[model samples]
Target: MAEYRLKTPLSNEDVEKLKSGDIVYLSGTMYTARDAAHKRLVDLILNGEELPFELEGAVIYYVGPTPPKPGEPIGSAGPTTSYRMDPYAPILIEHGLKGMIGKGKRNQDVKDACVKYKAVYFGATGGAAALIAKAIKKAEVIAYPELGPEAVRRIEVEDFPVVVVNDTFGNDLYDEGRKLWEKK
Candidate 1:
């Protein structure tokens, strides 16, 4: 149940120190980006357009959710499947992106980027929309409002729980952890 508050972008060393099942309380700043957003972001890089935000040590959360209720800032936001973002992740990692928040498996290049750039890929529980949404305290769109669900947002989260999926050293706890349990 260790807690971490991210005031600045996290370093690779900082990411690796985290292990599976560790509770993370991320704050300061986080950018929300889903499948469409990822595509646009990578395209920006390819075109040499400046990014809307700094990526160094930044954690990108993959989510596309229902519209928020009138008074709420967000609605039913949960970790979406991570595999869809894999193709563009390597480029982001190269550009100083340090952390990613999502659920499920990632490609080998993404893992390789983790090793090469000292980044980490984190997984929040899937199908726990209501519970996970509680971690988010505030939300505001920072880019691509026209994209609807694909819009990027700046969100503030408290006591956000996440597990380290891929470590900078190339260890995948998802596979290893499950295999260990399966052997029992």
Candidate 2:
């Protein structure tokens, strides 16, 4: 229940202050990637090739936005199911990714990675794509344009809303809520 406004690229201190269930309004830059983009990112890391963007302190949103309407930077940019990227998340986290925005729960490896890496996972509201799109001030395809909507895009956001689903301390909001409900 605490509310915080944070800017990226997030610092370790910034993530350490957060706890699961805290509401966060994030501003500054974030990148977009789905499963395909994530795989490519991991491949680049494994190959010791240059990545399209800097990974240190970076936040990646699990989204593939639809084509924008006139005068808009993006469209219907809701978070996709996060688990799809679970396979590659730990590697990215180990490499310096600091945050993630998506829906649903992440696997144990991802949660553990957060604790080990001082990273955090934020849950964006699903079915609120259009509303979320409003927060994106600018977007540009930075890599893998052939992936189309799944392409990696660099985006700037202003007060983009999210909730801390998993924190650097290995706390999980969904599990906490489940326990609370069971107690009730």
> Residues 1-184, candidate 1, lDDT per residue (tens digit)?
2556554468766876766555666665788998889999999999999998998889898988678999887999998999999989999999999889999999999999888887888889899998888888888999999999889998887777787778777888778878878953
Return the top candidate by lDDT. Answer: 2
Total clashing pairs for each candidate: 0, 0
Worst 10 residues of 1 by lDDT: 1-10
List all candidate RMSDs to the true structure: 1.9, 1.1
Worst 10 residues of 2 by lDDT: 175-184
TM-score of each: 0.91, 0.97
Model 2's TM-score against the true structure: 0.97
lDDT scores of the candidates, listed in order: 0.84, 0.96
For residues 6-77, write the lDDT of model 2, one tens digit per residue.
Answer: 999998999999999999999999999999999999999999999999999999999999999999899899
